[model samples]
Target: MPLDLPSDSDTATLAETFRLLGDPTRLRILFFCLEAPRSVGDIAESLQLSQSLVSHHLRLLRGARLVRGNRLAKQIFYELSDKHVSGMLADMAHHVREDD
Candidate 1:
């Protein structure tokens, strides 16, 4: 199937959001964020991934505006950028379970 491209700014935003969700690691990171804001260390520990690898995925997610990060003390905490991400994930979860 061919991928659709959004012509306008709004569609472009949607396209970017889809791109962010296309990666499994990014999806897992988003789920982790859904629970609470976490630092790269927290993500690494929870996901059992190396810090460098988690940081790499985080950089892409941040660039896509799917997630936001803030510095507190010495650690950078990340969370979902908007409510839509959580809504989309919830919808996806429902569809996946329906398929089973």
Candidate 2:
């Protein structure tokens, strides 16, 4: 089937989403989250990032609706917002791996 053209708002929003994804740190965060939901400290430790830096990027990702945080006890665990986000990350990984 032919792809449907996106509306102006959708195009703008997609541009914004791509813009956010363009950051290496954000991409690492998303890729890490894809494996499993993680707390801020876990992400910081795993990615070798400062807690405040991770928190800052997480805020932007949360605002963009690209990620969601769940509360367990006093910890906030974050992951991709939904399957679509997961698929997008997976597809991108596949594409990069293809070396095309």
TM-score of each candidate structure, all chains considered together: 0.80, 0.90
Across 37-94, the per-residue lDDT of candidate 1 in tens digits comes to 9999999999998999999999988887778999999999999887877888878877
lDDT tens digits, residues 35-97, model 2? 999999999999999999999999999999999999999999999996776898898899988
The window of 10 residues in a row where model 1 has the poorest summed lDDT is: 1-10
- How many clashes in candidate 2? 0
**Each model's total of backbone clashes:** 0, 0
lDDT of each: 0.88, 0.93
As a whole number from 0 to 100, the lDDT of residue 90 in candidate 2 is 97
Q: Quote the positional error of residue 40 for candidate 2 in Å.
A: 0.4
Worst 10 residues of 2 by lDDT: 80-89
The most accurate candidate by lDDT is 2
Clashing pairs in 1: none
